[model samples]
Target: MIEAVSLTKRYGNTVAVDNLSFSVKPGKVTGFLGPNGAGKSTTMRMALGLDNPTSGQIRIDGKIYQDLKYPLRKVGALVDPRWVHPNRSARAHLAWMARSNRIQAKRIDEVLDAVGLTAVAGKRVGGFSLGMSQRLGIASALLGDPEILMFDEPVNGLDPEGILWIRNLMHRLADEGRTVFVSSHLLSEMALTASELVVIGRGKLISQSTTDEFVARASDDAVRVRSPHLQRLRGALTDAGATVHEVDDAIIVSGMDSANIGETAAAHNVVLHELSPQQGSLEQAFMQITGDSVQYHSDLDEAPGQVLASGTN
Candidate 1:
Protein backbone atom coordinates (compact mmCIF):
# COMPACT_ATOMS: atom_id res chain seq x y z
CA MET A 1 0.00 0.00 0.00
CA ILE A 2 1.06 3.62 -0.57
CA GLU A 3 0.29 6.01 2.24
CA ALA A 4 0.80 9.73 2.80
CA VAL A 5 0.37 11.49 6.11
CA SER A 6 0.21 15.25 6.25
CA LEU A 7 2.47 15.33 3.22
CA THR A 8 3.36 18.86 2.24
CA LYS A 9 5.80 20.51 -0.14
CA ARG A 10 6.84 24.11 -0.44
CA TYR A 11 8.63 26.11 -3.14
CA GLY A 12 9.80 29.50 -1.96
CA ASN A 13 6.71 31.13 -0.45
CA THR A 14 4.29 28.94 -2.37
CA VAL A 15 2.89 25.68 -1.13
CA ALA A 16 2.66 22.98 -3.74
CA VAL A 17 1.15 20.27 -1.54
CA ASP A 18 -0.58 21.10 1.70
CA ASN A 19 -1.36 18.65 4.46
CA LEU A 20 -2.37 15.98 2.00
CA SER A 21 -3.03 12.48 3.24
CA PHE A 22 -4.31 9.53 1.25
CA SER A 23 -3.71 5.83 0.90
CA VAL A 24 -3.70 3.77 -2.28
CA LYS A 25 -4.40 0.12 -1.69
CA PRO A 26 -3.33 -2.84 -3.75
CA GLY A 27 -5.58 -5.03 -5.95
CA LYS A 28 -7.28 -1.99 -7.46
CA VAL A 29 -6.55 0.78 -9.92
CA THR A 30 -6.56 4.15 -8.18
CA GLY A 31 -6.85 7.34 -10.18
CA PHE A 32 -5.22 10.61 -9.14
CA LEU A 33 -7.33 13.55 -10.26
CA GLY A 34 -6.97 17.31 -10.02
CA PRO A 35 -6.99 20.39 -12.15
CA ASN A 36 -3.75 21.80 -13.58
CA GLY A 37 -1.50 23.35 -10.88
CA ALA A 38 -3.19 21.22 -8.23
CA GLY A 39 0.19 19.89 -7.06
CA LYS A 40 -0.41 16.40 -8.43
CA SER A 41 3.01 16.40 -10.14
CA THR A 42 4.68 17.54 -6.92
CA THR A 43 2.99 14.79 -4.93
CA MET A 44 4.04 12.14 -7.44
CA ARG A 45 7.61 13.50 -7.41
CA MET A 46 7.72 13.30 -3.63
CA ALA A 47 6.46 9.73 -3.72
CA LEU A 48 9.31 8.83 -6.08
CA GLY A 49 11.85 10.72 -3.94
CA LEU A 50 12.61 13.13 -6.79
CA ASP A 51 11.74 16.00 -4.42
CA ASN A 52 11.71 16.13 -0.65
CA PRO A 53 8.62 17.14 1.23
CA THR A 54 8.72 20.23 3.38
CA SER A 55 6.96 18.40 6.21
CA GLY A 56 5.13 15.15 6.86
CA GLN A 57 5.87 11.96 4.94
CA ILE A 58 4.85 9.67 2.11
CA ARG A 59 5.60 5.99 2.41
CA ILE A 60 5.53 2.86 0.34
CA ASP A 61 4.36 -0.02 2.49
CA GLY A 62 5.39 1.83 5.67
CA LYS A 63 8.89 2.70 4.41
CA ILE A 64 10.07 5.89 2.76
CA TYR A 65 11.12 5.59 -0.87
CA GLN A 66 14.76 6.57 -0.31
CA ASP A 67 15.15 4.00 2.43
CA LEU A 68 14.15 1.12 0.18
CA LYS A 69 17.18 -1.01 -0.72
CA TYR A 70 15.87 -1.88 -4.19
CA PRO A 71 13.29 0.81 -4.84
CA LEU A 72 12.70 -0.22 -8.45
CA ARG A 73 11.79 -3.75 -7.41
CA LYS A 74 9.10 -2.38 -5.12
CA VAL A 75 7.90 0.69 -7.01
CA GLY A 76 7.94 1.16 -10.77
CA ALA A 77 7.06 4.61 -12.10
CA LEU A 78 6.77 6.26 -15.52
CA VAL A 79 6.53 9.88 -14.54
CA ASP A 80 8.27 11.20 -17.66
CA PRO A 81 8.40 9.15 -20.82
CA ARG A 82 11.05 11.43 -22.38
CA TRP A 83 13.68 10.82 -19.70
CA VAL A 84 15.46 8.29 -21.93
CA HIS A 85 18.64 8.95 -23.88
CA PRO A 86 17.50 9.72 -27.42
CA ASN A 87 20.43 7.97 -29.08
CA ARG A 88 20.13 4.80 -27.03
CA SER A 89 18.32 1.74 -28.32
CA ALA A 90 15.22 0.71 -26.39
CA ARG A 91 16.95 -2.54 -25.40
CA ALA A 92 20.04 -0.67 -24.24
CA HIS A 93 17.97 1.70 -22.14
CA LEU A 94 16.20 -1.14 -20.35
CA ALA A 95 19.51 -2.95 -19.88
CA TRP A 96 20.98 0.14 -18.23
CA MET A 97 18.06 0.45 -15.85
CA ALA A 98 18.14 -3.26 -15.07
CA ARG A 99 21.84 -3.11 -14.29
CA SER A 100 21.35 -0.12 -12.01
CA ASN A 101 18.66 -2.01 -10.08
CA ARG A 102 20.57 -5.33 -10.08
CA ILE A 103 17.87 -6.80 -12.32
CA GLN A 104 18.61 -9.84 -14.50
CA ALA A 105 19.67 -8.97 -18.07
CA LYS A 106 17.17 -11.49 -19.49
CA ARG A 107 14.31 -9.50 -17.92
CA ILE A 108 14.84 -6.82 -20.58
CA ASP A 109 13.46 -9.05 -23.33
CA GLU A 110 10.39 -9.89 -21.29
CA VAL A 111 9.44 -6.24 -20.84
CA LEU A 112 10.22 -5.42 -24.46
CA ASP A 113 7.84 -8.11 -25.62
CA ALA A 114 5.29 -7.17 -23.00
CA VAL A 115 5.14 -3.61 -24.36
CA GLY A 116 5.09 -4.72 -28.02
CA LEU A 117 8.49 -3.08 -28.50
CA THR A 118 10.52 -6.20 -29.07
CA ALA A 119 10.50 -5.54 -32.83
CA VAL A 120 11.93 -2.08 -32.23
CA ALA A 121 14.19 -2.99 -29.34
CA GLY A 122 17.29 -2.21 -31.43
CA LYS A 123 15.94 1.10 -32.75
CA ARG A 124 17.20 4.32 -31.21
CA VAL A 125 14.62 6.06 -29.04
CA GLY A 126 15.27 9.31 -30.94
CA GLY A 127 13.53 7.92 -34.04
CA PHE A 128 10.56 6.42 -32.21
CA SER A 129 7.16 8.00 -32.53
CA LEU A 130 5.30 9.38 -29.51
CA GLY A 131 3.25 6.20 -29.17
CA MET A 132 6.37 4.06 -29.35
CA SER A 133 8.07 6.28 -26.80
CA GLN A 134 5.15 5.84 -24.46
CA ARG A 135 5.32 2.09 -24.92
CA LEU A 136 9.04 2.16 -24.13
CA GLY A 137 8.31 4.16 -21.01
CA ILE A 138 5.74 1.55 -19.96
CA ALA A 139 8.22 -1.20 -20.66
CA SER A 140 10.76 0.53 -18.45
CA ALA A 141 8.24 0.79 -15.66
CA LEU A 142 7.54 -2.94 -15.93
CA LEU A 143 11.23 -3.89 -16.14
CA GLY A 144 11.57 -4.36 -12.40
CA ASP A 145 8.44 -6.53 -12.26
CA PRO A 146 7.49 -4.41 -9.28
CA GLU A 147 4.43 -4.94 -7.15
CA ILE A 148 3.43 -1.29 -7.41
CA LEU A 149 3.20 0.83 -10.57
CA MET A 150 2.73 4.53 -11.06
CA PHE A 151 2.00 6.17 -14.40
CA ASP A 152 1.53 9.83 -15.23
CA GLU A 153 -0.45 10.61 -18.36
CA PRO A 154 0.32 7.13 -19.65
CA VAL A 155 -1.96 7.54 -22.66
CA ASN A 156 -0.80 11.02 -23.59
CA GLY A 157 0.29 10.22 -27.14
CA LEU A 158 -1.42 7.09 -28.29
CA ASP A 159 -4.00 6.01 -30.83
CA PRO A 160 -7.17 4.24 -29.80
CA GLU A 161 -5.52 0.85 -29.80
CA GLY A 162 -2.59 2.06 -27.73
CA ILE A 163 -4.89 3.66 -25.22
CA LEU A 164 -6.94 0.47 -24.95
CA TRP A 165 -3.75 -1.55 -24.52
CA ILE A 166 -2.57 0.56 -21.60
CA ARG A 167 -5.98 0.49 -19.99
CA ASN A 168 -6.15 -3.28 -20.23
CA LEU A 169 -2.56 -3.58 -18.95
CA MET A 170 -3.38 -1.55 -15.87
CA HIS A 171 -6.42 -3.72 -15.22
CA ARG A 172 -4.32 -6.84 -15.61
CA LEU A 173 -1.74 -5.54 -13.16
CA ALA A 174 -4.36 -4.68 -10.57
CA ASP A 175 -6.01 -8.05 -11.06
CA GLU A 176 -2.72 -9.72 -10.19
CA GLY A 177 -2.91 -8.07 -6.75
CA ARG A 178 -0.53 -5.25 -7.68
CA THR A 179 -1.01 -1.65 -6.81
CA VAL A 180 -1.70 0.50 -9.87
CA PHE A 181 -1.89 4.26 -9.42
CA VAL A 182 -2.46 6.34 -12.54
CA SER A 183 -2.88 10.05 -13.06
CA SER A 184 -4.50 11.43 -16.18
CA HIS A 185 -6.55 14.39 -17.38
CA LEU A 186 -8.82 12.13 -19.41
CA LEU A 187 -11.87 11.75 -17.22
CA SER A 188 -13.67 9.49 -19.66
CA GLU A 189 -10.83 7.00 -19.73
CA MET A 190 -10.29 7.27 -16.01
CA ALA A 191 -13.95 6.54 -15.45
CA LEU A 192 -13.61 3.28 -17.32
CA THR A 193 -10.14 2.37 -15.99
CA ALA A 194 -10.03 3.31 -12.33
CA SER A 195 -12.25 1.80 -9.68
CA GLU A 196 -11.15 4.16 -6.94
CA LEU A 197 -10.25 7.84 -7.02
CA VAL A 198 -7.90 10.17 -5.14
CA VAL A 199 -9.12 13.65 -5.93
CA ILE A 200 -7.24 16.78 -4.92
CA GLY A 201 -7.61 20.51 -5.46
CA ARG A 202 -5.17 23.31 -4.63
CA GLY A 203 -2.79 20.84 -2.97
CA LYS A 204 -5.40 19.67 -0.47
CA LEU A 205 -7.23 16.40 -0.35
CA ILE A 206 -10.76 16.87 -1.60
CA SER A 207 -11.99 13.27 -1.70
CA GLN A 208 -10.81 9.69 -1.71
CA SER A 209 -13.44 7.09 -2.46
CA THR A 210 -14.72 4.61 -4.94
CA THR A 211 -15.15 6.16 -8.40
CA ASP A 212 -18.88 5.45 -8.38
CA GLU A 213 -19.32 7.13 -5.02
CA PHE A 214 -17.38 10.21 -6.11
CA VAL A 215 -19.41 10.60 -9.26
CA ALA A 216 -22.68 10.01 -7.45
CA ARG A 217 -21.85 12.62 -4.84
CA ALA A 218 -20.77 15.25 -7.34
CA SER A 219 -23.59 14.88 -9.89
CA ASP A 220 -27.31 14.87 -9.49
CA ASP A 221 -29.35 11.68 -9.78
CA ALA A 222 -32.25 12.01 -12.15
CA VAL A 223 -34.90 9.83 -13.74
CA ARG A 224 -36.27 10.17 -17.21
CA VAL A 225 -40.03 9.76 -17.43
CA ARG A 226 -41.81 9.25 -20.72
CA SER A 227 -45.60 9.17 -20.77
CA PRO A 228 -48.50 10.19 -22.93
CA HIS A 229 -49.72 12.32 -20.01
CA LEU A 230 -46.50 14.28 -19.78
CA GLN A 231 -48.13 17.42 -18.37
CA ARG A 232 -49.97 15.50 -15.66
CA LEU A 233 -46.90 13.55 -14.70
CA ARG A 234 -44.91 16.78 -14.55
CA GLY A 235 -47.49 18.18 -12.14
CA ALA A 236 -47.39 15.02 -10.03
CA LEU A 237 -43.60 15.11 -9.85
CA THR A 238 -43.48 18.82 -9.03
CA ASP A 239 -46.10 18.40 -6.28
CA ALA A 240 -43.91 15.63 -4.79
CA GLY A 241 -41.05 18.14 -4.26
CA ALA A 242 -39.27 16.99 -7.46
CA THR A 243 -38.02 19.38 -10.10
CA VAL A 244 -39.30 18.50 -13.56
CA HIS A 245 -37.98 19.72 -16.87
CA GLU A 246 -39.12 18.90 -20.37
CA VAL A 247 -36.94 17.68 -23.22
CA ASP A 248 -38.68 16.63 -26.40
CA ASP A 249 -41.48 14.25 -25.47
CA ALA A 250 -40.09 13.30 -22.07
CA ILE A 251 -39.84 14.90 -18.64
CA ILE A 252 -36.60 14.70 -16.67
CA VAL A 253 -37.30 14.48 -12.95
CA SER A 254 -34.71 15.19 -10.25
CA GLY A 255 -34.85 14.71 -6.47
CA MET A 256 -36.57 11.34 -6.90
CA ASP A 257 -35.64 7.89 -7.99
CA SER A 258 -37.35 5.59 -10.47
CA ALA A 259 -39.04 3.70 -7.67
CA ASN A 260 -40.61 6.79 -6.18
CA ILE A 261 -41.63 8.08 -9.59
CA GLY A 262 -43.15 4.74 -10.52
CA GLU A 263 -45.14 4.61 -7.33
CA THR A 264 -46.32 8.17 -7.86
CA ALA A 265 -47.32 7.37 -11.44
CA ALA A 266 -49.26 4.33 -10.24
CA ALA A 267 -51.04 6.42 -7.61
CA HIS A 268 -51.91 9.05 -10.22
CA ASN A 269 -53.09 6.31 -12.63
CA VAL A 270 -50.72 7.68 -15.30
CA VAL A 271 -49.70 5.43 -18.18
CA LEU A 272 -45.94 5.34 -18.58
CA HIS A 273 -44.29 4.46 -21.87
CA GLU A 274 -40.76 4.58 -20.50
CA LEU A 275 -39.10 5.21 -17.19
CA SER A 276 -35.35 4.92 -16.90
CA PRO A 277 -32.83 6.03 -14.35
CA GLN A 278 -30.22 8.45 -15.58
CA GLN A 279 -26.58 7.90 -14.71
CA GLY A 280 -24.13 10.72 -14.06
CA SER A 281 -20.92 10.75 -16.02
CA LEU A 282 -17.43 11.21 -14.61
CA GLU A 283 -16.77 14.25 -16.80
CA GLN A 284 -19.87 15.95 -15.46
CA ALA A 285 -18.91 15.13 -11.90
CA PHE A 286 -15.30 16.28 -12.31
CA MET A 287 -16.29 19.58 -13.88
CA GLN A 288 -18.93 20.22 -11.23
CA ILE A 289 -16.66 19.28 -8.33
CA THR A 290 -13.43 20.88 -9.51
CA GLY A 291 -14.82 24.10 -10.92
CA ASP A 292 -13.59 26.19 -8.02
CA SER A 293 -10.24 24.44 -7.81
CA VAL A 294 -9.15 25.32 -11.35
CA GLN A 295 -6.23 27.74 -11.12
CA TYR A 296 -6.91 29.41 -14.45
CA HIS A 297 -10.39 30.26 -15.67
CA SER A 298 -11.31 30.91 -19.27
CA ASP A 299 -14.08 33.34 -20.19
CA LEU A 300 -15.55 31.30 -22.98
CA ASP A 301 -19.01 32.47 -22.04
CA GLU A 302 -18.21 35.91 -23.45
CA ALA A 303 -19.03 36.29 -27.15
CA PRO A 304 -16.18 37.37 -29.47
CA GLY A 305 -18.19 40.32 -30.81
CA GLN A 306 -19.11 41.45 -27.30
CA VAL A 307 -15.52 41.33 -26.21
CA LEU A 308 -14.43 43.36 -29.24
CA ALA A 309 -17.12 45.96 -28.68
CA SER A 310 -16.26 46.26 -24.98
CA GLY A 311 -12.57 46.62 -25.80
CA THR A 312 -13.26 49.41 -28.29
CA ASN A 313 -15.31 51.29 -25.70
Candidate 2:
Protein backbone atom coordinates (compact mmCIF):
# COMPACT_ATOMS: atom_id res chain seq x y z
CA MET A 1 0.00 0.00 0.00
CA ILE A 2 1.04 3.62 -0.61
CA GLU A 3 0.30 6.23 2.06
CA ALA A 4 0.58 10.00 1.72
CA VAL A 5 0.32 11.86 5.01
CA SER A 6 -0.18 15.64 5.13
CA LEU A 7 1.99 15.96 2.06
CA THR A 8 2.82 19.51 0.99
CA LYS A 9 5.09 20.90 -1.69
CA ARG A 10 5.93 24.49 -2.64
CA TYR A 11 8.10 26.05 -5.32
CA GLY A 12 8.79 29.63 -4.28
CA ASN A 13 5.41 31.41 -4.01
CA THR A 14 3.45 28.71 -5.77
CA VAL A 15 2.04 25.96 -3.60
CA ALA A 16 1.96 22.91 -5.86
CA VAL A 17 0.54 20.47 -3.34
CA ASP A 18 -1.12 21.47 -0.06
CA ASN A 19 -1.45 19.09 2.83
CA LEU A 20 -2.80 16.37 0.54
CA SER A 21 -3.22 13.02 2.24
CA PHE A 22 -4.51 9.75 0.83
CA SER A 23 -3.76 6.06 0.63
CA VAL A 24 -3.70 3.64 -2.30
CA LYS A 25 -4.52 0.14 -1.25
CA PRO A 26 -3.33 -3.00 -2.93
CA GLY A 27 -5.47 -4.97 -5.42
CA LYS A 28 -7.43 -1.94 -6.62
CA VAL A 29 -7.31 1.02 -8.97
CA THR A 30 -7.29 4.52 -7.41
CA GLY A 31 -7.66 7.35 -9.88
CA PHE A 32 -5.92 10.68 -9.29
CA LEU A 33 -8.02 13.50 -10.75
CA GLY A 34 -7.31 17.22 -11.25
CA PRO A 35 -7.23 19.84 -13.93
CA ASN A 36 -4.11 21.02 -15.64
CA GLY A 37 -1.70 22.73 -13.19
CA ALA A 38 -3.66 21.31 -10.26
CA GLY A 39 -0.49 19.54 -8.99
CA LYS A 40 -1.34 15.93 -9.83
CA SER A 41 2.09 15.43 -11.35
CA THR A 42 3.82 17.19 -8.46
CA THR A 43 2.12 15.00 -5.89
CA MET A 44 3.13 11.92 -7.85
CA ARG A 45 6.72 13.09 -8.16
CA MET A 46 6.96 13.56 -4.41
CA ALA A 47 5.58 10.07 -3.83
CA LEU A 48 8.42 8.59 -5.85
CA GLY A 49 11.14 10.77 -4.22
CA LEU A 50 11.75 12.43 -7.59
CA ASP A 51 11.11 15.70 -5.71
CA ASN A 52 11.24 16.49 -2.00
CA PRO A 53 8.15 17.71 -0.15
CA THR A 54 8.13 21.06 1.60
CA SER A 55 6.63 19.31 4.63
CA GLY A 56 4.95 16.03 5.56
CA GLN A 57 5.76 12.66 4.09
CA ILE A 58 4.68 9.69 1.97
CA ARG A 59 5.54 6.01 2.26
CA ILE A 60 5.39 2.82 0.28
CA ASP A 61 4.65 0.04 2.75
CA GLY A 62 5.45 2.26 5.79
CA LYS A 63 8.97 3.06 4.59
CA ILE A 64 10.24 6.24 2.94
CA TYR A 65 10.74 5.72 -0.78
CA GLN A 66 14.39 6.72 -0.57
CA ASP A 67 15.04 4.04 2.02
CA LEU A 68 13.63 1.14 0.01
CA LYS A 69 16.34 -1.46 -0.39
CA TYR A 70 14.92 -2.48 -3.77
CA PRO A 71 12.80 0.50 -4.75
CA LEU A 72 12.16 -0.65 -8.31
CA ARG A 73 11.04 -4.05 -7.07
CA LYS A 74 8.45 -2.43 -4.81
CA VAL A 75 7.09 0.41 -6.95
CA GLY A 76 7.04 1.12 -10.65
CA ALA A 77 5.98 4.34 -12.28
CA LEU A 78 5.48 5.93 -15.70
CA VAL A 79 5.46 9.64 -15.01
CA ASP A 80 6.95 10.80 -18.30
CA PRO A 81 6.75 8.69 -21.42
CA ARG A 82 9.28 10.94 -23.11
CA TRP A 83 12.14 9.65 -20.96
CA VAL A 84 13.17 7.17 -23.63
CA HIS A 85 16.09 6.92 -25.99
CA PRO A 86 14.76 7.08 -29.54
CA ASN A 87 17.51 4.98 -31.03
CA ARG A 88 16.98 2.02 -28.71
CA SER A 89 14.61 -0.80 -29.49
CA ALA A 90 11.79 -1.51 -27.03
CA ARG A 91 13.61 -4.62 -25.73
CA ALA A 92 16.93 -2.77 -25.45
CA HIS A 93 15.36 0.02 -23.38
CA LEU A 94 13.98 -2.33 -20.73
CA ALA A 95 17.16 -4.36 -20.80
CA TRP A 96 19.20 -1.25 -19.97
CA MET A 97 16.89 -0.45 -17.03
CA ALA A 98 17.20 -4.03 -15.73
CA ARG A 99 20.98 -3.91 -16.07
CA SER A 100 21.16 -0.61 -14.13
CA ASN A 101 18.99 -2.03 -11.34
CA ARG A 102 20.90 -5.36 -11.30
CA ILE A 103 17.75 -7.13 -12.46
CA GLN A 104 18.07 -10.37 -14.40
CA ALA A 105 18.29 -9.72 -18.14
CA LYS A 106 15.73 -12.48 -18.90
CA ARG A 107 12.91 -10.36 -17.37
CA ILE A 108 13.18 -7.82 -20.19
CA ASP A 109 11.49 -10.23 -22.61
CA GLU A 110 8.80 -10.97 -20.04
CA VAL A 111 7.73 -7.33 -19.71
CA LEU A 112 7.87 -6.78 -23.43
CA ASP A 113 5.50 -9.70 -23.87
CA ALA A 114 3.30 -8.52 -21.02
CA VAL A 115 2.78 -5.14 -22.65
CA GLY A 116 2.09 -6.72 -26.06
CA LEU A 117 5.29 -5.21 -27.39
CA THR A 118 6.98 -8.50 -28.14
CA ALA A 119 6.16 -8.13 -31.80
CA VAL A 120 7.78 -4.67 -31.92
CA ALA A 121 10.50 -5.21 -29.34
CA GLY A 122 13.21 -5.27 -31.98
CA LYS A 123 11.97 -2.08 -33.70
CA ARG A 124 13.67 1.23 -32.90
CA VAL A 125 11.66 3.41 -30.52
CA GLY A 126 11.98 6.34 -32.92
CA GLY A 127 9.89 4.39 -35.39
CA PHE A 128 7.07 3.87 -32.88
CA SER A 129 3.76 5.68 -32.90
CA LEU A 130 2.47 7.44 -29.81
CA GLY A 131 0.46 4.39 -28.75
CA MET A 132 3.45 2.11 -29.30
CA SER A 133 5.67 4.43 -27.30
CA GLN A 134 3.18 4.35 -24.45
CA ARG A 135 3.24 0.56 -24.47
CA LEU A 136 7.01 0.64 -24.41
CA GLY A 137 6.85 2.95 -21.39
CA ILE A 138 4.56 0.52 -19.61
CA ALA A 139 6.93 -2.32 -20.46
CA SER A 140 9.79 -0.34 -18.94
CA ALA A 141 7.85 0.31 -15.73
CA LEU A 142 7.03 -3.39 -15.34
CA LEU A 143 10.59 -4.50 -15.93
CA GLY A 144 11.18 -4.95 -12.21
CA ASP A 145 7.95 -6.91 -11.64
CA PRO A 146 6.81 -4.39 -9.05
CA GLU A 147 3.61 -4.88 -7.09
CA ILE A 148 2.63 -1.21 -7.08
CA LEU A 149 2.35 0.59 -10.40
CA MET A 150 1.61 4.25 -10.97
CA PHE A 151 0.60 5.56 -14.37
CA ASP A 152 0.32 9.28 -15.15
CA GLU A 153 -2.01 10.07 -18.04
CA PRO A 154 -1.53 6.60 -19.47
CA VAL A 155 -4.09 7.18 -22.19
CA ASN A 156 -2.80 10.61 -23.21
CA GLY A 157 -2.25 9.60 -26.84
CA LEU A 158 -4.09 6.56 -28.10
CA ASP A 159 -6.84 5.35 -30.35
CA PRO A 160 -10.07 3.92 -28.97
CA GLU A 161 -8.69 0.39 -29.13
CA GLY A 162 -5.52 1.41 -27.35
CA ILE A 163 -7.47 3.12 -24.62
CA LEU A 164 -9.57 -0.02 -24.13
CA TRP A 165 -6.43 -2.11 -23.97
CA ILE A 166 -4.92 0.08 -21.23
CA ARG A 167 -8.17 0.11 -19.31
CA ASN A 168 -8.34 -3.67 -19.36
CA LEU A 169 -4.64 -3.88 -18.52
CA MET A 170 -5.13 -1.81 -15.36
CA HIS A 171 -7.97 -4.04 -14.21
CA ARG A 172 -5.97 -7.11 -15.07
CA LEU A 173 -3.06 -5.88 -12.95
CA ALA A 174 -5.38 -5.23 -9.99
CA ASP A 175 -6.98 -8.66 -10.48
CA GLU A 176 -3.54 -10.15 -10.11
CA GLY A 177 -3.41 -8.61 -6.60
CA ARG A 178 -1.22 -5.75 -7.73
CA THR A 179 -1.91 -2.14 -6.77
CA VAL A 180 -2.67 0.16 -9.68
CA PHE A 181 -2.66 3.90 -8.99
CA VAL A 182 -3.34 6.02 -12.05
CA SER A 183 -3.97 9.67 -12.83
CA SER A 184 -6.10 10.84 -15.76
CA HIS A 185 -8.06 13.80 -17.11
CA LEU A 186 -10.61 11.61 -18.86
CA LEU A 187 -13.64 11.69 -16.59
CA SER A 188 -15.80 9.30 -18.59
CA GLU A 189 -13.05 6.73 -18.79
CA MET A 190 -12.19 7.16 -15.14
CA ALA A 191 -15.82 6.81 -14.17
CA LEU A 192 -15.89 3.42 -15.82
CA THR A 193 -12.37 2.16 -14.99
CA ALA A 194 -11.56 3.44 -11.49
CA SER A 195 -12.86 1.65 -8.42
CA GLU A 196 -11.96 4.66 -6.23
CA LEU A 197 -10.96 8.27 -6.75
CA VAL A 198 -8.83 10.94 -5.13
CA VAL A 199 -10.05 14.30 -6.42
CA ILE A 200 -7.97 17.42 -5.87
CA GLY A 201 -8.12 21.06 -6.88
CA ARG A 202 -5.40 23.70 -6.79
CA GLY A 203 -3.15 21.44 -4.73
CA LYS A 204 -5.86 20.91 -2.07
CA LEU A 205 -7.73 17.71 -1.44
CA ILE A 206 -11.36 18.03 -2.51
CA SER A 207 -12.59 14.47 -2.14
CA GLN A 208 -11.47 10.92 -1.42
CA SER A 209 -14.09 8.26 -1.86
CA THR A 210 -15.18 5.25 -3.80
CA THR A 211 -16.59 5.83 -7.29
CA ASP A 212 -20.10 4.97 -6.16
CA GLU A 213 -20.07 7.39 -3.22
CA PHE A 214 -18.66 10.19 -5.34
CA VAL A 215 -21.34 9.62 -7.93
CA ALA A 216 -24.02 9.49 -5.28
CA ARG A 217 -22.95 12.89 -3.97
CA ALA A 218 -22.80 14.55 -7.39
CA SER A 219 -25.30 12.79 -9.61
CA ASP A 220 -28.87 14.08 -9.49
CA ASP A 221 -31.16 12.17 -11.78
CA ALA A 222 -33.89 14.72 -12.35
CA VAL A 223 -36.58 14.62 -15.00
CA ARG A 224 -36.58 17.54 -17.45
CA VAL A 225 -39.85 18.66 -18.97
CA ARG A 226 -40.60 20.97 -21.89
CA SER A 227 -44.02 22.25 -22.96
CA PRO A 228 -45.90 25.25 -24.32
CA HIS A 229 -48.01 25.36 -21.11
CA LEU A 230 -45.03 26.50 -19.03
CA GLN A 231 -46.97 28.75 -16.65
CA ARG A 232 -49.55 26.14 -15.78
CA LEU A 233 -46.92 23.42 -15.23
CA ARG A 234 -44.85 25.85 -13.15
CA GLY A 235 -47.79 26.72 -10.97
CA ALA A 236 -48.82 23.08 -10.49
CA LEU A 237 -45.28 21.90 -9.78
CA THR A 238 -44.61 24.84 -7.45
CA ASP A 239 -47.89 24.04 -5.65
CA ALA A 240 -46.63 20.48 -5.30
CA GLY A 241 -43.17 21.78 -4.18
CA ALA A 242 -41.35 20.23 -7.11
CA THR A 243 -38.22 22.04 -8.21
CA VAL A 244 -38.49 23.63 -11.65
CA HIS A 245 -36.31 25.57 -14.08
CA GLU A 246 -37.06 27.64 -17.19
CA VAL A 247 -35.14 26.81 -20.30
CA ASP A 248 -35.34 28.62 -23.65
CA ASP A 249 -39.12 28.32 -23.89
CA ALA A 250 -39.95 25.42 -21.62
CA ILE A 251 -40.23 24.43 -17.97
CA ILE A 252 -38.02 21.75 -16.39
CA VAL A 253 -39.37 20.04 -13.30
CA SER A 254 -36.73 18.48 -11.07
CA GLY A 255 -36.42 17.05 -7.55
CA MET A 256 -38.67 14.15 -8.69
CA ASP A 257 -38.26 10.97 -10.71
CA SER A 258 -39.80 10.31 -14.12
CA ALA A 259 -42.84 8.54 -12.70
CA ASN A 260 -43.65 11.42 -10.31
CA ILE A 261 -43.09 13.96 -13.06
CA GLY A 262 -45.48 12.13 -15.32
CA GLU A 263 -48.07 11.69 -12.59
CA THR A 264 -47.81 15.35 -11.62
CA ALA A 265 -48.18 16.44 -15.25
CA ALA A 266 -51.28 14.30 -15.68
CA ALA A 267 -52.79 15.37 -12.37
CA HIS A 268 -52.29 19.06 -13.07
CA ASN A 269 -53.79 18.61 -16.58
CA VAL A 270 -50.40 19.74 -17.93
CA VAL A 271 -49.22 18.90 -21.44
CA LEU A 272 -45.62 18.01 -22.11
CA HIS A 273 -44.01 17.48 -25.51
CA GLU A 274 -40.70 16.42 -24.00
CA LEU A 275 -39.94 14.89 -20.60
CA SER A 276 -36.59 13.23 -20.06
CA PRO A 277 -34.38 12.76 -17.07
CA GLN A 278 -31.47 15.16 -16.94
CA GLN A 279 -28.82 12.59 -16.11
CA GLY A 280 -25.92 14.57 -14.79
CA SER A 281 -22.65 13.71 -16.50
CA LEU A 282 -19.43 13.00 -14.68
CA GLU A 283 -17.91 16.20 -16.11
CA GLN A 284 -20.63 18.29 -14.47
CA ALA A 285 -20.05 16.56 -11.15
CA PHE A 286 -16.30 17.18 -11.42
CA MET A 287 -16.85 20.86 -12.25
CA GLN A 288 -19.30 21.33 -9.40
CA ILE A 289 -16.96 19.77 -6.82
CA THR A 290 -13.93 21.86 -7.83
CA GLY A 291 -15.55 25.13 -8.86
CA ASP A 292 -14.03 27.29 -6.14
CA SER A 293 -10.47 26.11 -6.73
CA VAL A 294 -10.59 26.50 -10.50
CA GLN A 295 -7.42 28.27 -11.63
CA TYR A 296 -8.98 29.59 -14.84
CA HIS A 297 -12.34 31.34 -14.92
CA SER A 298 -14.47 32.58 -17.77
CA ASP A 299 -15.98 36.06 -17.99
CA LEU A 300 -19.47 34.76 -18.51
CA ASP A 301 -21.04 33.61 -15.25
CA GLU A 302 -23.30 30.77 -16.28
CA ALA A 303 -23.84 29.18 -12.91
CA PRO A 304 -26.56 26.54 -13.02
CA GLY A 305 -29.39 27.88 -10.94
CA GLN A 306 -31.47 25.65 -8.68
CA VAL A 307 -34.97 26.37 -7.45
CA LEU A 308 -38.43 25.04 -6.84
CA ALA A 309 -40.85 25.19 -9.80
CA SER A 310 -39.18 28.08 -11.65
CA GLY A 311 -35.62 29.37 -12.29
CA THR A 312 -34.13 32.01 -14.61
CA ASN A 313 -31.08 31.60 -16.90
Worst ten in a row by lDDT for model 2: 304-313
**Local error of candidate 2 at 302, Å?**
11
The residue pairs in collision within model 2 are 244-309
State residue 178's C-alpha deviation in candidate 1, in Å. Answer: 0.6
- Over 4 Å off, model 2: 224-235, 245-252, 257-278, 297-313
Instruction: Write one digit per residue (lDDT tens) for candidate 1, span 235-256.
Output: 9889999999998999889999
Locate the minimum summed-lDDT window of 10 residues in model 1: 304-313
Q: In candidate 2, what are the lDDT values of residues 1-313, reduced to their tens digit?
A: 8889999999999898999898999899999988667889998898899999999998888988899887888889998887888898888888878887788989988888877888888889988988888888888778888999999999988899889988999999999999899999899999888998899988989998988778768877667788777798788888887888887876666677778777878998888888887667667888878878777554434555533322111
N/CA/C clash count, model 2? 1
Please tell me which predicted candidate would have the highest lDDT against the true structure: 1
Residue 259 displacement in candidate 2 (angstroms): 7.7
